[model samples]
Target: MTAEKRIPLHILREITNGFSEHSRIGRGGYGDVYKGVYSGREIAVKLLHVDTVLGHDDRQYINEVGNLLKVKHPNIVQLLGYCYEIQNELIEHNGANRFTRHVYRVLCFEYLQGGSLDKHLREESFAPDWSTRYKIIKGICEGLNFLHSCEPPIFHLDLKPANILLDSSMAPRLADFGLSRLFGGSHTHVTNRVVGTEAYMPPEFIKDAYISHKNDVFSLGLVMIEIIKGSSGYSGYIETDEVGQFTQKVLGNWKNRIKATSEYPLEESHQVQICIDTAMRCVEPDRNNRPNIAEVLDILSKTETHIPKRQMADVFPCPTIGLKSESNMLEIMVAELNNNEHIHCNLMPTDNSNRTVQQLADRETSSDVEQVIIGRTKEKQKILSILSESITEEMVNLPIYGIGGIGKTTLAQLVFNDPKFQDYTRVWVYVSQEFNLNKIGNSIVTQLTDKISNIPTK
Candidate 1:
């Protein structure tokens, strides 16, 4: 690891305006982070929580700085400088204020305007299409591979959406090395003190306290699934599905999305399938069953070969430099991927055999609403499927919520007009905040007044 500058606390304060509230940008387990200007460039400064970090021999701070110093990959967040200092400060002790020595530790990084990956995933109003999400996932895998490829490998024990930051281009950079660890020649280590976000922790770490590079794989699987499925956590039922079912279900979700939003649905759907297959394998319950980062990245790279050569630059915007693999090698990898026996190569339908999606399109009623809405196909199908399956003589109300211009109204219209529900009584009621049960009931009664006399209360 190269030596990093030991920035003085005063300089940090100057850049961050004495860590003012307005300058504060984010918070984490270790400390609060602030946006600052250093050497004419914007940077992020993380100030260690004095109580939690100062007394523990400062191992966490040192560990993060050490790991950051060793890495120089584009997908890895760069460490600009660090601050370690001790100063006399005012403190309250035993009902009196006194002066005491305070140890201040901070780390700085290049400012990324797109912020954390979790923010982009959490905002429901705006969703990036398949191409953007796929690149972010692939970038993360590449970063993880670089870490594992280090001579004395580094493992990001705390890998999750929040720990990944993005640039304006939406390319991801892995960050927050407070929980990272470096190992020499050992593949796995057992640590008694297992600490990380529990949702992303591998089962072995929670139960057996065993950690290997596959631990990161487990977290990456969850993160990738969340990315693929738009931050649903993929936590409970999604992870439990058998391989084939899960692949089809997720591929179906993206397939529907790509069909509506892409000029290249065929290639994009194939990419989604590869991602799901890799993600499922990454999350295998047995750590030994999970593929290493290198293997995971190898498969992800094959997506590039499948994409049209002209569109490859747009799909994978942040490809590696100074290295180009043989095109034949990638084709060989694709062949190996096809023969992997476990993978279900359900790409495009060659003929009428694949008319299922086409038939859904065929059945869609051409209504006054189009001009053709761009991205609500999957959601429309989901609502229709739910209504179809769960409409057994009971009132089913599914409330869709989002900010203005997210197509909540357009989706409602699509579902209302769909032929699948022609037999079922369809009542469209747009409710307001000052809602009245009698008013809504009266509207429902009015709609049903002419449509059916029975009202099918049965």
Candidate 2:
């Protein structure tokens, strides 16, 4: 099924504005996240960076969304929606005023109040105890196992402490799917461009070696070792044999102590010892020796009884908010803007192959033609951005008008991917010369509803 069209900007402003300062949660390379109430339930909103480059190919975003939509395991992050829109501004280029605006993409998901596992390990005040750490590791393993067990299988290209989020009960959930890949059976190896954070990537991946599910296993092992050592300094090579020797010595002593301690009880001491052993096995230098996700899950399952489960629901109170339909206000605004206008909004039947088009007639005076054209472009972009932030049910359709090769399509693309529009679900289709009304209407309907064929035309 086709994905939903990108949200407009006026809606984005409304969504962001509704998010009070107190609800601001975290910040990252993309943008800031805010805790908000949606439909009387709590949710997390990840605002994408307007200037962030999503690459020329749109498949990256499409792949990530498609992957998330298929997986429904409790350990993985749930994608609620996304936003896309354009923004216009003046930039200084070679001492001249260059008019350009960028398209932004944002995604929304279920909120995890406990923050990331990295935050807990790095912060002294929130450092997880031995028991909590063990449980978190098992939870992550379970998530990886689920991903690896998919029919064609899925691979999380990027796996690190920061990407692992924890719920209110401290249960771990994997987030950030911008770099994930879904594989097919016949495809034994994927040789695409390398994309991921440096430190977390495995040696084979960085060197452009054939990547498989084993690559993710290697990264998971590295994360496991870091958590065990309670050290964030996993980057850079080990300078001296002393560090490795020191670690081995500590494990040896702990093992001997557990064997001798009859008073302390073997069960408690054995749990800690088993965790260390498993971590060592995971970070083996040779990829062939690294355990698969299934084996990791098996090891974790054996120790499950030792770790306690925390109920995430007990931590945060549910918000009592109601969904407000903003369609009327949107219609009114569009009408006012279209007053004495040269564009006509048409309701036509479209299919999954193109966008619904609104034909426009440009009535411009020769003297102020350029000024009028530029001004209208910026206004349209701004309006689209606003619609994205609002997250209303109705589809947002705005057609940019200009002569061929005058950047009309380019401007629409910029508006569709704007970061400010990230909060709503979205998709963009180019309908340049192939404009079938039935196909276009069907495409819009499919995107908004995820159904194929027989879409009702208005």
Candidate 3:
């Protein structure tokens, strides 16, 4: 599979407002994430730090993009684009000033409105309920299984709460592939340079740099444990015991959770217990003892699995806020799925046949539509001129009226895609026959800025 299109650095800077502090949403090991808008879509841009761009960092960047190019699954974040541009800058070297050109790497990813899994975790007031938590666990396992099942196998060295993002529907999407490595038909790759979040890294990986599919499985196990227990449990769990002891402690907690409430179905409790047991097996000190991701997933699917009916919580945008409302849950779920087509992604087949992988790869990397834009040179220039003359700082509104089947939407798309207005944040709201002001407002707010806006209410 080929990687995402290489975006221009200038366009990135323009969209991100010069990487301003206001645009900054989160920080990673090598860089900061900024929220940006391009082509009427919200995107997350990871700007790698200049100081942290060492030789190894370059390899890590390349590895991440390459591995992401090879995989496509519902739980994995979509790579929208990337930028690798070099520019000359003056700096002091060895107590003297000098000028040198440095390459800056920036990765663009789909912006998840729900933010990271860590955001709604234990400490947050918006912590997900048991059912939502179960869905998240299943999603993570499925995503990890896909990675492990890859031809060469992709190992996500970091699989902590912070690395897992959630879409608008609270579905988990794995992100942050900077620490990933591709295992080329080898059982393990041993090295002295151990790199990963300490809490999530397996013992073997940390001590011996033993890299393999099990490494990610072990990390996923920790993440699962943290999900069931809170992140606060990490300290006590690590301090009190080894993997075996940890497993026993987790099993004890599972038993308590099962016995605590009669409302919790016995079958569901059994499935939860299986998940905990799978996690325990994954964290085994010996790589040979650890269950592979496939095995873990197989064990997780032991219970009766079925499509979950949407609960009452699915009807409201802020269920955690205790807002009283009565509505049909299934209808709400269907409406939501229709409203946001991106979150409707489904799991791909587990088997890594060349045809399957190739088909998936082709769908993502295809530039056919992009190449067929048929840039109407004269029309584009005229529209650009009109927009330049009409737009003002005081929110000037211009309406372009046309009959159905006319290229009105196409013209707007061309304008939005133009490079001249790359600096401005664009939001496209389709207010069809059912014109709801609140919905349009929320949609525009969500598209332009994520930090200041509350979660959108449909």
Candidate 4:
């Protein structure tokens, strides 16, 4: 994260084509969001409407920025820059021309390519795999947990699918903090100025104007349900008196999907069950009965205990033949062990054992092969960031795993050939399902010997 800088409004207008309608990405109660480029990187710009009266929107902007500045978490959206500029223009008021003061309030965030989770949940045809959904649910929980862990605890009063943005890799980041509040002693507050999506609001927040960490918990439960059972899940839950039966039905729906798609159907099925159970517990009408975010995450962590300890997968791209042939053979991942990153990454283990590769990134690789590789720059940069941060003296093996035909090999190749690795003796050995640590070690030794043998005797 970088320090929040004040950006000029003119620069934003230019980047967004004078805030054209086509550039607008979303609208909210306080303002409009637009896609814009800043400092050569894609960014999201929020243009907040100024209300000359009670100045409530101003408080929203301040509240959002203030909380955002205090928090830093991977699952939480990052604030890159902001703009607060005052402009005066001549306007006819009371049948006389006068200069009126107007203030521009803008916020900039790192652009997310996958858009909001609301869109995904609302789309009947769009179903993200169970793994992606589980990851998102867990991410939201962790972020909520982080907010709750803050000193005095920050409550995200507005928590919903619409406020959760997905990145290129489908990771969820919490956004929209206008309604968040910080409560110190007793960890509770009461205010009648209730605002936010009604459906996600808990009984206490909506009925009594009561607020607590559990307020966000209740909302989180609704969000997790929607992520698991579609946008209609919450409605169905509220309608059901037999919560146990409703949960089973939700789990059953996911089980069928897992049967069709997931390799670890049992593990995914277990996750789906936990999510349903957690959601049921989180949305309890009595705030006292609702599980806190930490407790929710505690339960989510148990999901890992049910999953297999290891499921290593190998991926490499082969020459594309035809649609049928390529689908069958282009990606051959052998897995008996499983890791989340291994699920959908295109990375490989390192060959260097004697000296760790300190920097595994950020040099160009424009070979003829890479010229054909499209839509992998973000993946490449992400790997480079991970590599660049590794301890200079230690080895960090990054295994790339992803669904079939997702260009895992292309990303691996991109990172491997980057000029940053020029100093290292490179070795490329394809490992398959029959993963033999001894055999892999021998192969690396043989490659190192061959490279040494080829070196000039001088």
RMSD of each: 23.0, 24.9, 21.2, 14.3
> For this target, which candidate reaches the highest TM-score against the unseen true structure?
4
- Give the range of the ten consecutive residues with the poorest summed lDDT in model 2: 309-318
lDDT by residue (326-361, candidate 3, tens digit) is 133323433544566433112222222222111111
Worst 10 residues of 4 by lDDT: 330-339
What ranking of all candidate models by TM-score puts the best one first? 4, 1, 3, 2
Q: Which of the numbered candidates is closest to the native, going by highest lDDT?
A: 1
Q: Could you tell me how far off, in angstroms, the CA of residue 117 lies in candidate 4 after the best superposition? A: 0.6
- Which scores higher on TM-score, 1 or 4? 4
Per-candidate local distance difference test: 0.73, 0.61, 0.67, 0.72
The regions of model 1 sitting more than 4 angstroms off are 1-4, 52-57, 96-99, 125-127, 237-245, 309-458
Model 3 worst lDDT window (10 residues): 312-321
Give the lDDT of residue 156 in candidate 4. 85
Clashes of each: 0, 50, 0, 11
Per-model TM-score on C-alpha atoms: 0.64, 0.56, 0.61, 0.66
Clashes of 2: 50
- Candidate structures ordered by lDDT, highest first: 1, 4, 3, 2
lDDT of 2 by residue, 169-209 (tens): 77799987776778886534657666667786666667765
What is the clash tally of candidate 3? 0
Q: Comparing candidate 1 with candidate 4, which one achieves the higher lDDT?
A: 1
Q: Roughly what TM-score does model 1 have, to 2 decimal places? A: 0.64
Q: Can you give the lDDT of residue 194 in candidate 4?
A: 63
